[model samples]
Target: MTILIALLSGLVFGVAFGFLLEKSRVFEPGVVVAQMQLRNFILIKVWFSAIVTILIVVTLLRELGIVTLHPKPVLLIGDLVGGLLIGTGMTLAGGCPAMIMAQIGAGYRDAWFVVLGGLAGLAAYLTLELLLRPLPADGPGPLTLAGLSGTPFPALAVAVGVGLFACVIALERLRPWRLDLGAQADGIHHDRPGSPRRP
Candidate 1:
């Protein structure tokens, strides 16, 4: 039942993603690349807006007793290592996991490789985790950014909010697309590259 629910939720989210991607007209290479090049700041603006919204919503909900925030461990070293690996992989692949799925939805046939790569990555993570189960539970217990900073929860949240706002402000003034999303698509769409897209 949990598996079924998860699968259903994934499908629902995929449909929603498609609807929004189409509605926003952001699936177009021009939009994605423009955001990347700092030409248009759609990516930055939307993400920072989302981060701020989530922070506010979660904070209010926690204060209202409508939700519980179990502060998770902040393994700074693990995070730094994982982020570097993921960043390198993304740079080489020219697309992250989410973008791969978006391309697949956009009728890109080569996304199969991306899907395969994602599955392989997931499997490797699971395998490594199982092999090294002793480190996670025993190593770091209930670490948080606040714990590191000795700051109150609200202070940490405010810091995060300010950082997000600053990033959005910085992105709002970018010029135009420098790296073509379609080119990064890696021959995914054989049609007119960087063409004016309607859908």
Candidate 2:
């Protein structure tokens, strides 16, 4: 019963997440590619905002004893390799896993290929897991910033969330979201320098 409830909760949250992503237009191929090329700030803004919000929510849940924090083992080598692979794939596909799903939901035909490629990659990784040994035997035990810094989890979460939220605000101010949208309210492409100002 608990498992079934958890699954239903996940379904609800997943739908909400996808709806938000679609509305934000961050799942668009152009937007994703622009972000990878550092030509747009919308993706980073959304990413940081999500991170900060999650951190705060999780901290509150922990304080209320509604959830427990379980840090994963710090496998530096595995993380580096996985990050490189995921980053390369995302750059090539112009969408990460989550973004690709949203793209498909938004009626993008090309996103299907990206999804297949991701599954192929996963299959390849599983087949080569033994030979590649990406997960080494030795890794730093599950460690959290709070544990490392000898601070309470709630305090660390608050500090980190505040810092990231500040960054999000600064980014929005420096490069307004409308600039990255590629088209202004007047339907003019004035993102480039020397372009006619929006009326």
The estimated TM-scores of all candidates read 0.68, 0.84
Give the local distance difference test score of model 1: 0.65
Stretches of candidate 1 off by over 4 Å are 1-6, 21-41, 123-138, 174-199
Worst 10 contiguous positions by lDDT, candidate 2: 182-191
The per-prediction tally of clashing pairs is 2, 0
Error (Å) of candidate 2 at residue 187 is: 13
Q: Model 1: per-residue lDDT, tens digit, 11-54?
A: 99988977776544455444555555544455556567878999
Best by lDDT: 2
lDDT of 2 by residue, 1-199 (tens): 6999999999999899899988887888778877887777778888898898788788788899999878888878777877898888888997888889998988888889998888898899889989878465467878888889999888888888888889888888888988778753221356578877767
Score residue 25 of candidate 1 by CA lDDT. Answer: 42
List of clashing residue pairs for candidate 1: 39-175, 39-176
